[model samples]
Each structure stands twice: as C-alpha cells, then as structure tokens.
Target chain A: MNKTVLQIIRFVVLVLFQVLVINHIRLGGYVHPYIYMLFIMLLPFNTPKWQLLVLGFALGLTVDLFTGTPGLHAGATTLMAFCRPSIIQLISGNQKFENIPEPNLGQLDGMWFFRYVLCLVFVHHFALFFLESFSFRLIGQVLLRILLSVPVSVFLIMMILYIFKRERKRE
Target chain B: MYNLQRFILKHHFVILFILLEVISILLLARSQNFHRNSLVNTSNVVVGKIYEWSSDVGNYFRLNTANEQLAEENAMLRQQLSIVYDTASCVYDVNEGDTLYEYIPAKVVNNSTNQANNYIIINKGARDGIERDMSVISTDGIVGVVTDVSRHYASIMSLLHSKSVVGVRFKNNQEIASVKWQTNNYRYGIVEDIPTHIVLQQGDTILTSSHSKIFPEDLMVGTVEEFYPTAVDALNKAKIRYATDFSTLRHVYVIKDLHKAETDSLKAKFQ
Candidate 1:
C-alpha cells in the first residue's frame, strides 16, 4: 500500500477506535489510555517539520471534538510533534532519519523502537493530562492518571506495531 | 532584509509550533470560561447521538443493578402509597389542588464522575421538556441539575461537580446548610455554614431545603459521615456520603416543578 494512503487509513481507524471503544472503557475511573498518539508516532520519518505539526494539530483537534474538551488534546499532541524529532535522535543514536521512511518495528531494532515509543508516549500523556486538569490542586490525581495510563498506552501501541508488522511480513 | 528573511525561513517551524500551541491554549481557555456555552459541549447533536448509541450497548451491562434499584424503589413507593391512601378510608383525604411537581424518566447516556465539573448526558432533552435548572434524581437520591439542552439530549451538571452546591439541612433538626463536592471522590461531599451549636450525629440524614427552586424541599441529599467544627467561629462543617452512587447510576428522573416559573418570576419581582 502507498505510505500516504496507509497513514490516512490508520488515522481514521485509530481516531474511531479511540473515541468509540477506548473512551468507553472507564476502568475504575482512573485509567483512560489514549493510543491515538500512535498515529503521530507512525508518520514517515522524513516528513517535514511543518507537516508534522499540522498533522498533529489535526489529530488532536479531531480527538477533542469527540471527547468534548476543546483544546486539551490539541496542545498536548502538538507538543508531542514538536518534541518527536529530538526524541528520535536521542533514542536511535547516529542512525539518520533520512534513510528511514517510517519508524516501525520492522526497520528499527526492538529495544530502540520500544524506548522511542515509550518516551514519546510518556510526553504525550503527561502533557495531555496536565492540560486537561490545568490545576495545581489536583496535581496528585493528575499525576496518578498519567502514571496509570502511560504503560497501557505503550502496550497498546506496541501491539498495533506487532500486528501491522506481521501483516506486512505475510504480504 | 535578506538576513531577516533567512532567519524567518529558518525559524518558521518553531514559529508554527508556538502558533498552533497558542491557538490550542486559547481554545482551552475559551471552553473552560464557565459561561455555559452549549455549542461547544459534548451534548451537541452529533456527539450525543453517538453516545446514545454506545450507551444502548453499555446499558445492558448495568441491567442487573438497574433492575435491583427499580425493585427497591417500587417497594418503597408501594409502602408510601399505602400510607398516603389510608386503605381504611376508601374516599381518602387527598386534595385535587396539591400537585406541585412532575417527573420525566430519562436514561443516562453518558456520565463522568472523574472530572472537576462532571457533566452527565441523558437521553432526555428540550423536546422532552427538559430545561436548564431542572433537578435530576435517581431512585436512590439527588443526582444533579440540568445545565444544557439540545433538541434530542440534555447535559446535567452532576452533584459531583466542583461548582455544584445543594442547600441541605439535617432531617431531624431542619437546620440548613449547603453541600458541595470538594474532592474528586464521587461518594462524598462537604457541608458548609451549619451553626456550631447545631447538634450532629454521624448517621444523621440530610435533606434538600426550600432554599432554591432547583430542587424540591426535603429531597434526600445524603447522610452525615463526619463533623469538624471551626476553632474561631466554631461552625459545624462536616463530610457527607452522597446517597446516589454515581458510579452505578443508569436511570434518573428529571423533576419538572409545575410552579417553578411562577415562583421564579415572583421571586424575581422582589429582587
């Protein structure tokens, strides 16, 4: 499949999945995993900085539209996009992104890919929860939410990667 | 001029990033402005419709609890009806002019108890005569007040909301105070402004007062769980365990007071 077309399909599927299914899983009112950040993470490595920011904005705003919070998702996801390049560089040392079309489990080594996804997911959830609460009083609760959500989101994202990689291998 | 253009070209990504972030923050600020803008909320048509559909599926999981609640309420109502009817006298002592309130049953389509100002979206709306400030109650106890409405759905500001305050008093003494949610825990609320000298017991029941037209007088609010008096003024402040278990809430009745408009207008004249 064409990379652009594939990314587009992934965007739609992930957004629908996030809003329809994951949003309803109110486990003990504490953990709400946002796996839609995986969409931003899976974008082509050589994608322009400006395009990445815009895509991130669009992704976050779409989520906000569904979740009823206007700007919480947008701010956090945009920050994630801005920090992505730095995180990729710091995680995968010396290997330039120019040769890498997309960052997936297929091309990147398992340990580095896991680290990269973990760091970015952490940043995304941290920013998302803090922006949603926007309060110093419930800082403890907000931190707990982020702590509970990060691992779940990471595991879900990696599962998607594994499934997609297996499908590609079969093709 | 060339140097400036080069700088602009080089830093445009950073500029764009900041610009988008600023726009997002502005949107966040606008939505949280608390002016009760109905247009931007989740209870609007598209989102509400989707939630209504999903809730249909989710409701099945909560069926057993809903059934139990209904049965308990029915038994209680049967006992109350027996008292009101006075079976010994078939003619009864009830008057025709005593009707002051009506109720519309609604299904809870979407509810959240985790947020600071939690809102519940119910299947009822303006078309069903649900309007802002109408009181919502589950079979168990007081739920919240209607805050926003679309044609097909309405949003309720749940009692768990930080801004939610209910005028309440001890059932035995009729000593009035207010209850507000000060913590994220959905089961509890804080009581404010009770006189220090007012006697309190740990298990004393609290009821809604006639203080606001939003809720009817003497509706069940909660039971006192703890009491702490201030040192200087020595006012009785305490914690209450809410009667309605919001986590298990599925069905509720939106109370429509027939005399609310008249009372509100008359009160407005004095103000």
Candidate 2:
C-alpha cells in the first residue's frame, strides 16, 4: 500500500481497536490500553510538523468521540505529536532522520527508538491524566495511572512497530 | 517583507500547533455542549444499543455475584418490609404482577455524578408519569428531584452531588434545614440553619421536614455525627452522616401521589 493508504488503514484500525477491542480489555474495571498513539509514532521523519500535529488532533478527537471525553485525548495526543520531532532528535543524535522512513526501529536501533517512543508516550499520558484530574487532590492516583498506562501503551506500540519492521524486511 | 513572509511560512508548523492546542483547550473547557452531531455519543441510540449489548454480556458474567447480592438484599428487604408492612398489609417483589403495576420502573439511560449540574436519566418520561419537580428516591432514601423529562427519559439530581438541595429536619425536635451536599464527604452533609438555642446533641436523628413539598414528612435523612457553631451566623450546624449509600445507588423511584398537586397547593396557600 502507498503512504495515504497506509495512513488511512492505521486510522481505521486504531479507531476500531480502541472502541471495540481495547475497551473490553478492562483491568480491574478501570485501566484501559490506548494504542492510538501509533499514528504519531509512525509519522515520516521529515513530514511537515503541521501534518503531524493535525494527525494527532484528529486521532485524539476521534477517540474522545467514542469515549465521550471531548478534548482530553485530543489535547494529549496533539502534544505528543508536537514534541515527537524533538524527542526523536534527542534519541537519534547525529543521525539525520530526514528521509530513511520514519521510526523503523531498524534505522534508529532498538534502545533509541524505545526511548523516543517512551518519552513521547509519557508526555501524552501525563498531560492527559493531569488534565482529567482537575480536582488536584488525586495527584497520587493520577501519577500511578499515568505510570501504569504509559508502559503498557508503549509496549503495545513497540510490538506493532516490530511486526511492521519484520514484514518490511521480508518484503 | 519577503523574509517576514518566509518566517510565517517556515514557522507555520508552530502556528498550526498553537491553533490546534487552543481549540483543544477550548473544547476541553466546554465539553458538555460539544456533542453536536450526537452520532458518536453514548447517548446516541445506536451506540447505546451497542453498549447495552456489551453490558448484557458483562451482566452474564456478573450473575453469580448479582445473585448473591440479591439473596442477601431479599432477606433484608423482607425483614424490613415485614416491619413496615406486615403480611396482612402486603408482600410482593418489584417484578410481581400486583406490585409492579403500582410503580413505573425506568432504566438509567445516562448519568453523571461529577458535575455542578449533575443529573441522572431514567428511561421513563412525561408519557410515563415523570415530570419536572417529581420526587425521586431510591429504596434507601431521597435520591433527587426530576428536572427534565423527554418522551422516553427523565433526569434527576443525585443527592450525592454538591448541587442537591432537599428539605430536611431534625427527626426528634423538627428543626428544619435544607440539605445541600458539600462534595467533600460522600455519605455525610452539613445541615445548616438550626437555631443555636435548639440543642443539637450528637447521634440526634434528622428527617425530611415539611419545608419542601418534594420529600414527604418523617423520611429519614441521617443522624447528627458532629455539631459546630458557625461564627458567621446565629444558626448552628450539624454534620449528618447519611443512612443510605449514595454511591452504589442504581435504582430509584419517582413518586406520583394520588393527591400530590392538590395537597401541595393547599399547603402553599396556608404557608
């Protein structure tokens, strides 16, 4: 599939998975996995920062629609996308990440890509949990939820990236 | 001028990011009205049906636990109901033919307890004897008042909420005070406006006063847990630990008295 096709497929898969699948994966009737950030993580390295942010907003808004939380997810995801480039640069130091297809753990290596994904994921989740916790009393709960959810989200996203990479190598 | 235009173009990504974030913030601040299309909302009929199906599946798995709860509740209700109404008075469950006919049951369509203007939705509405200002109470105690009624649903203010205000009184001496939830305590309330002269001893039972036409007289509110004299006002206050568990409240009843409006108007005229 071409670039547009792949992006569209990613969008559809993420939305369906979030609404139909991940929602059912209830841990203790609370904790839910958000694999929707795959869109931000897989953006092409040199894609205009504008496109990345828009994609993030769209992804977040779509999830919010399903979950009945209007801007919570959208703001967090957009923030993640906005900071992705800087985070990627930090991890891939001296590696000019212009062309070589965005976020092929093969191109950036495992540890760097993991850290890159981890930083952006933490940023997205922290913003989200903090905003949702408007009362300011539940700081411990908010931090704990963020800490627990981020690693799970990142692990799922990395597994997806790995599968895609292995498929690319076979091709 | 060309460089300035180039700057705008070059840093346009930052501008776009700012714009999107601003929109997101605005939307976040005002989320209650953002469901314009209603297509993706849980309130939508299609989405409601989908969730209903899933909840049904979950309900199946929860049956054993539900049965255990029901059995325990049944014995408790039986004992209590027997005391309230002896075997000679009546004895029948909610699902029974005769008892079911007396009360209109409604499914909770949508609900939120975390807002200033919190409301609970029941599937029954105007056509189903629900109207504005109707008294809504669970088997436990007062839940709230019906505020809005649609063709198929009605919304009620939850008593657990900070916004709920109901007429309350001291069960023993009949000291009237309006009960408003402070949100700090889930199962307690600050009953205000009791005169300082009237002694408030701890463990004093409070009940629904005749101050409001919504709650009938003598319905239990709670017992006084603590008392303090607020310096700002002449009246004393009591912290009432409520009898009912407001959080686990799932089902409620909307009262429709045979002489409701007539009795209210007559009492209003006297007042």
Candidate 3:
C-alpha cells in the first residue's frame, strides 16, 4: 500500500476507535487513555515538521469536535507534535534513523521503542490534562489523572503496536 | 533586510507552531465562557449526527436501565395525576389556565463526566423547541442547563462542570445555598453559603431554590453528605451526593419556562 494511504487508513481507524471505544472506557474516571496520540507517534521519521504539527492539530480538532471541547486537545497535541523532534533526539541519543522509516516495534528494539513511547506519551498526556483543566486550582486532580492515564494509554498503544508487529512478522 | 528574511525562512516552523498554539489557546479560552456558541463543538450538525449514530448503538446495551428509569418516572407521574387527587371546596386564590413550564424530551447523544469541564449533547435542538439557558433534568434529579444549540442538537453545561453552579435550598427549611463541583468527582458537589444558624442533618434533601431563573423551584438537586463552617466567612459549606448519576444519564427533559422572559426582564431591572 502507498504510505499516505496507509497513514490515512490508520488515522480514521484510530480516531473512530478512540471516540467510540476508548472514550467510553472509564476506569474510576481517572484512566481516560488518549490512545489517539498514537497516530502522531507512528508517523514516519522523515515526515516534515510542519506536516506533523498540522496533522496533530487536525487530529486533536477532530476529537474536540466529538468531545465538545473545542481546542483543549488541539492545544495539547500541537505542543506534543512541536516537541516530538526534540523528544526523539533526546531519547535516541547518537542513534541514526537512516534505515528506520518509523518508530515501531518492528524497526526498533523493545526497550528503545518503549522509552520513546513513554517520553512522547508523557508529553502529550501532561499537556492534555493540564490544558483540559486550565487551572491550578485542581492541580492535584489533574496531576493524578496524568499519572494514572499515561501508563494505561502507553500500555494500550503498545498492545496495538504489538498486534501490528505480529502481523508484519507473519507476512 | 536579507538577514531578517533569512531568519524568517529558517524559523518558519517555529513561527507556525506558535501561531497554531495561539489559535488553540484562544479557542480553549473562548470555550471556557459558557455563553458563546463556539464554532467547533459536539452540537455541530455533522458531529452530532456521528454521536447520534454511535449512541444509537450504545443505547441498545443500556435499554434495560433506560426503561427502568422511564418506568420509575411513569409511576411517579401516575401518582400525581389529577384523578389521584381529592377535590375539596375552599376559599383558595387559584390562578387558572396558565402553563408555567413545558418539557421537551431529548436523548443524551453524548456525555462526559471525566473531564473537569464536562458537557452533554442532547438530540433535541432549536428545531424541537429547545433553546439556550433552558433547564435540563433527568427523572431522578437536575442535570444541567443548555449552553449551545444547533438546528438538530444542543450542548449542555453539566452540573459536574467546574463553572456550573446551581442555587439550591434545604427541602425541610428552605434555607438557600448554592452547589458547585470543585473537583472532578461527578457523584458529589460542594454546597456553599448555607446559614451557619441552621442545623444540618447527614441526609437532608437539597432542592433547587426560586432564586434561579433557569431551574424551576423545588426541583430535586441532591442530598447533604457532610458539612462544615468555613473559617473565613463563618458560613457553612457542605458536600452533597448528586441525585442524578451523570455517568448513567441517557434521557433528559429540556424545560422551557413560559414566563422566563418576564422574570428575566424583572430581574434585570435591579441590575
């Protein structure tokens, strides 16, 4: 499949899954995992920075439309996309991505991919929760939500990636 | 001039990032104000249609609970029918032939309680006689007030939202107070401005007071769970478990007050 077509398919599937399935999963109201960030995380390594930010904004806006929060997600996801290149550099250290097309379990070692996902997910969730609250008055609750939701979101994203990884391996 | 142009060209991505962030923040700020009809929201026709479709699937699984709730409300309304009441002749000043409020039934197309500023979208909108600032209530208790409406859907500012406040009073004594959700907990809210003189019980019922223009007086709000006097104001604040389980809310009524315009105009005179 063409790369753009594949990404588009992934985008639609992930957004629908996030809205219809993940948004309905409320574990004590604290574990609202935003696995939609996976779309931005899985973009190809050589994708342009401007495209990343725009796509991030679009994805978040789509979610906001469904959730009735106009720009909370958009703001957070845009910030995450802006920080993506720096986070990747900070995590990968001297490792080059000349051959690696995307950051996935298939291309990267488990530990490195885990660390990459953890850092980016943290950035996304932290921004998202804080922006959603938009006040320090409920800082404690917001912080708790971030702490509880990040691991769950990461786990869900990793499970999804693992499924993809197994399919590719079988092929 | 050339150097400036070069700087702009090199840092275009950074500039774009800043611009997008500013737009996002502006939108966030605008949405925080409940009165504004934001350009992007669940009440948008396309978005509401998508949620309506999804809720159609989701509602099938919740039909048992939804039916039970409707049955309960039906039983209660049955007891209030004129046929069930006894007629007595007395010198009573009765005002006849006036309908004070009208209710438009709506289905909860989408609702969220996990967010700090939660909102609910109902299937009824302008086309169905729904309007902004109308009170929304479930069979069990008060739900929210309509904040935005499109042609086919209306968005409600849920009582669980941080900015949502309701004027409520003790059902026993009519002592007025206001309920506000200070935390993310949807099951409970904080009651403010209770008179320190009134003795409160553990399970006192709180009902909406007449002070509110949107909500009709004496509507069930919640029950008092715990209370304490504030050190600064010497006024009592209490925690009340909300009567409406926002998490399970599916059906609601959008109430239209027939005399709201007159009441609003009268109240606006004092201001």
Best by lDDT: 3
List DockQ, one per candidate, in order. 0.56, 0.32, 0.72
Q: Which digits, one per residue and each the tens of the lDDT, describe model 3 over residues B99-210?
A: 7898899999889887777889899889999888999999889999999988888999999888888998899897888899965577999987888788788899999998
> Any residue pairs clashing in model 1, and if so which?
none
Candidate order by DockQ, highest to lowest? 3, 1, 2
Instruction: Give candidate 3's error at residue A78 in angstroms.
Output: 1.0
Over 4 Å off, model 1: A2-5, A24-32, A163-165, B1-9, B41-43, B87-98, B229-233
Q: For model 2, how does the per-residue alpha-carbon lDDT over A42-155 read when each residue is reduced to its tens digit? A: 878778888899899999988775455667789999999989878877776797856677677666678887888789889998888776654578677667777778888888
Q: Model 2 - which docking category? A: acceptable
Per-chain TM-score of chain A in candidate 2 equals 0.91
Q: Interface RMSD value for candidate 2, one decimal? A: 5.2
**Candidate 3 clashes between residue pairs 3 or more apart in a chain or in different chains:** none
Interface RMSD of 3: 1.4
Flag the better candidate by lDDT, 2 or 3. 3
| Residue B252 lDDT in candidate 2 | 61
Candidate 2 colliding pairs: none
